[model samples]
Target: MAREPLHLLKTVYGYDAFRGRQAEIIDHAIAGGNAFVLMPTGGGKSLCYQIPALCRPGMGLVVSPLIALMADQVAALRQAGVKAAALNSSLAPQERTAIWQAMEKGALDLLYVAPETLLRPAFLERLRAMRLSLIAIDEAHCLSQWGHDFRPEYRRLDCLADLFPDTPRMALTATADAPTRAEIVSHLKIGVENSFIAGFDRPNIRYAIAEKDAPRRQMLAFLEAHKGDSGIIYCLSKRKTEETAAFLNERGYTALAYHAGLDKAVRDANQTRFQREDGLVMVATIAFGMGIDKPDVRFVLHLDLPGSIEAYYQETGRAGRDGLPADALMLYGYEDIALRQRFIDESDAPEQRKRMERQKLDALLGLTETGQCRRQVLLNYFGESHAPCGNCDNCATPPEMFDGSIAAQKALSCIYRTGERFGQAYIVSVLLGAEDERISRFGHDRLSTYGIGKEHDARTWRSILRQLVAHGLVNVDLAGHGGLSISERGRDFLREKPALMLRIPARTGGRPAKAAPHEVARGIAPADRALFEALREKRLSIARAQNLPPYVIFHDKTLVEMAVVRPRDRRALEAISGVGHSKLERYGAAFLDVIARHSP
Candidate 1:
């Protein structure tokens, strides 16, 4: 039993060895110890429990968040020659009965279920009758209110601890801040000693942010480099998603729209298409991408600002899950921040929650406005330290900064003189001494601070005010009017006359240059390109015939390895990564034939 996990890794999952703390986490679970795992998305988290369930006695029970996610995991497990089943609302009556019988007979290795189903009285009674290996919870952060994606059903999961006191319980998630981790620990009754913090850093993703200037054109420009690649464009609204999808399709790109308003069948079909097909861009709102398992997403684009840094990290983390180079670009403006703030203010949440939301929004804005290393700032939020990652836009093209002490003072004075009633455009107009009718009507033209900002263009001043808002020196009014007012911090700065440095506005749309070509194409030798494409076509054909996503059979990374290694026989092929026993027995010959034909 001790050596079974390592044996299973090489024979079943086809990996040379465990990564990070996976060996320890799996051993802990197998030894009937509770555990908490906070690994990044592509950090081989599932193996921690999957290997344990196989090594231990009886069937393992996994609590998952979404039906689609559960189904995907179940499929992948079954493909690996494991006896896995999912019990959810999507299962037919006969299918559910079969699963129950399988569980009762102890013939199943693992079962994936939602909290709603697992907490039912009948379900709990049936489960108590059977010997269990362990109980694992995926996406455990959903149990906490501080978590970005909170679900009420997840809060009731702690009851499992009492119901099965002897059974080991493990909670796993890819995203959680310190506070959220604390809440999860408290809520689930998991011991603090079992917590494993596997750092929040996805080095394969290149982060970039640009102010929204001609958003459609900017989107097109960014997409130009990513053409014929699978990506997701996240919009702020459902209508915007549809419009963006249509815009892309009209310009000779394959795109689809997804949101909560769509019919259930349509949504499911679109999601399935996005998963099974390559080079299809999914233009969707926030409602679309929580549980998607597509591993080869080449990029993730945010058309507007997300609510918080946690949300941004989770969304962008969805890309580059295959450990390949992927891109994440965000297009934002001052209006997006105001809109997000208005949402927080207008919600029915308590005052405390509203304050927390504001702080989260400010942190996100700081990420967008920071002239320093974006990855460093992001990792610092999660209580981890990383050197300036050269992958992000700021690290690639560093922003120039200038002293703006007097400029900030003048801007603050104009905001105060205008009675904090005008938005940014009006304030910028007054600073430039525009003879507009609204200015004369408001009598703001007579203010002493007017025209004092003529040295900087409106773009520069706008950039200054944006940073000011991000730095907490200025606040946007919550009435949805976009009015700006100084905070206590701004007043302190005015009194102290401290020097401030602001980023100079980039004139060329503020976007990094196009990312390099696909990682696989750039990685393999030119002679091997033909074999790589042929192997990809073979994988796609098998995937389509089996009605599974191409990645479920083999990730592009694995295919790239196959193309480079060019193994000659079954023994040599089995030595390649991702060629587990089940996969080798099933599809090894087909790939080997392609390699043989193309070998020179």
Candidate 2:
């Protein structure tokens, strides 16, 4: 327990100093205090617990949420010269026996287990037999029943405190609001005062949200700039996941689909390829990112709106984990927002839960239509204060703001006039005097509101109504064919005629995303792009030879730094950021040869 964490970070993980609060967290956990940590992805959360686990006396037990995450983490740790293994259902008979023997002999430094495996009574009894050092619960937000990634097994982990009262336990998650944090504290039985909230702003990830117009075309346009990079595209449904993946693959992009509907082996393989290869895009539902640890994911795209800000943060946080510039683009629309609310309304979840879900959706929708900086609004949700990040889409080009008070009044009047029983499409058509079957049958065209909104087109009106829903002036009633219902706020607005400003998306060109900034900007000057690719090829070859993922051999960031520094000799190569003593000793000469072959 008295070992120095900075020493472990240097020799073991190949870093010099702790990035942010990692040193503080490590110190806290090493001193045998029950610690709760909330850190964003790519913020070096693993080291916070890993260092303490190594410094402490007994074996460190990490309760991870996903098998892929466990495997990836264990592999990365082993590559960094630490003894780590995962005990999940995926292990073979001999593998499990080997871990058990290792545990009995006090040979493991860090061992990861999934909730399902860790919660079994037999497993708990077996763990009781061991001299436990620390219990680290990664993705501890799963303990919150209200959060998106809820797990009942996580609720059972509170027993660990009762089971081993003296063992220092740590709960860590990238996403958790105050309520969820309270739940984690209550369920994990950890001290609320001991909790640490790391900064939620991921400045490395540029946030962009676009209205879903010609989604595949828009998605294609966005993907054009991201060719030859790894990314994730999230769809709302399984069918969409497959179709999107196929469509992208048909267009010559390396893409794969993953969902619970797919066979487990297929899901596993798709995940493995995404984890191990470059330039592969995973088209998946929410099922994909619970525990993914790929460090070089260049972007994370959402084809549909996420249900909550917590989910959006966690999913997008998956990108740029290596402290490099990455992108988060989302394409959403009125229907997408309405559809999410419809789900929440239709669910049998408790009334209080539904209210919370609706509020969460409203918050996310506000981000989409907000005129303020996207980064500012998002960080505000996590209780972190940040200036407008100059890099986000809003900061790059602010949305046009017009006096939407009249438009808001007209839209709310329309919802009120329609008996609040028809969906937005029908309402828009009624406004446009479409004379469609629904409009004609409703005989609501006779109303003064009808055809009065003809000043704006149907699409514009739809956008207005969607923003109205986002503004909480309108609600979606799923029981009535996704009808737009007027809220009390809407009624009050109608009565008061308040001045409202709505963000209007630019009609056309604003700014085109640069194509492959990582390669273009960082790859310029001393780092000959050709040499970097050659170095990447060499690293890939070594990874394949060792049967390890390419990043395990050396992350993309490390290779880029090498090309930039152009370390001519073995000693200089050892000074690179990710090149630890063991890594430098093991693969230093090969990388040095590659660097030397293409030295400028």
Candidate 3:
């Protein structure tokens, strides 16, 4: 029996084979099937439709939410020697007309358009005349009301699928939970049988959450420890994004800020720079990740807690696309929980929506506070099970926990002495037997347990309080509200002599040597280092000339492989991973000439 067309396309796309359910999804789409594809960010979701798009008889219609994604995908396909074009708001009238003409003349094999444009009667009429092999909906999670980036326009997508009922439709998103999956199916009218949920595990991404204290300093320390590596710092607000970016820039790092507040051109330029420039760090809000295609990001640090675990998973999933090791570091604080709760309380959403939002927030909090393996906690939330990932901070730098029974008793006694109505500050002051105005005002200095915890520093006591709350021994009474209160566990502890152990928070200030830089430089020959730089420059130039992502032209791995193999001809070049027939035909000569010129 002959090999499937998808297998051939996989070979042509420079992949040794399809991963997970890619083959099944691609085969289904090629057979004119409708599919709801829920694959993680690093998963090969694009190949599901790209392969089928190539095998089908006519142009593939890729409905994307962002103009950047459309342009990037079209550029990538064209670079792979597949005829492709994009029609979006950013294109000039002439460009749109040329694309329309190309479509009518069958000069393009793939056409990417924005959902808004697809809804326009004129564009739909024009599309009706062309034969559409497939309709791919990128970021399909946006169709769900429960999704973080829900766009009202996505609901209109069902009309296009109806209009092109005969064409196969594939809705692709990097992250979607069960509810979002149902929404995609219903909103897009996709059949249940065609739904494909790829495994959500991104094993290459190690997850860690640190309790927030001196976050800016922690961020700087993290950046210093991973210097010259590609990463993203996610903030909850535009101001934080700008401030963080500026701070990183001042520290001599290649950092940029991206948020909706920036002008369109500035955002585009920053994104382009980040993608093309090696080791550039992008500090951005949730608005940033939808269309980003960079593959070598070494880490994703969240300065604030994300609204939901789904959002966090999707955002962090952007790292380590090459299946290399990556880090997902998050800083959580009491303020983050309050901020999320406030948002949920103030929103005009229905009761059910608000409830769901709270559940999601709790899940994120659970992730932040859990002492178990970070990977296990994350995977368990997603209905998957895994053994402890021994790579995260919790596992590698296990906290030194001591019996905190005496400290807990003293802290609780202080809270009781202060009437259980004050915040941590008052409690801390009472525990230290401070004669400050607040302690005097509350008359907490005279308590029996006062001065008992004076041996520990104020910071140490605060750490214990945070850990206590995390361990469910205590709770913050949001109803009381925002004051410390003992939970049932705390009462039980007080009655039965509960034992406690707490991790001393790691101090953050000075920089440590960044993770082994030599690991990245390992395979490169000393002689070919300059040659590698030249190849990268050449690749960048081609990328710029065609307005495509640099990686689409040639990934870093491909360049490294080229340097190692020093292929002299197309046959030799074809043997390198990520260099398929299409890529070799398009880029082989230029690289070969470079290698030949540089050869001894």
Q: Pick the candidate with the highest TM-score.
A: 1
- Residue 399, candidate 3: C-alpha displacement in angstroms: 3.8
State TM-scores per candidate: 0.96, 0.94, 0.89
Candidate 3 C-alpha lDDT tens digits along 326-406: 778888766566667778988999999999997887787777765678778887877778887786666665555667888
Local distance difference test, each candidate: 0.89, 0.85, 0.80
Winner on lDDT (1 vs 3): 1
Model 1 vs. true fold: TM? 0.96
Which lDDT value does model 3 have at 232? 92
Error of 1 at 477 (Å): 4.7
Evaluate residue 203 in candidate 2 and report its C-alpha lDDT on the 0 to 100 scale.
85
Residue pairs with backbone overlap in model 3:
none
Tell me the tens digit of each residue's lDDT in model 2 across 398-483.
Answer: 88898999989877887788888888888888777777776768778788788878888776787788788778788886655777
Supply every candidate's count of residue pairs whose N, Cα or C atoms clash at under 3 angstroms.
Answer: 0, 0, 0
Off by over 4 Å in 1: 1-3, 435-445, 477-481
Comparing candidate 1 with candidate 2, which one achieves the higher TM-score?
1
When summed lDDT is taken over every stretch of 10 residues in candidate 1, the lowest stretch is 511-520
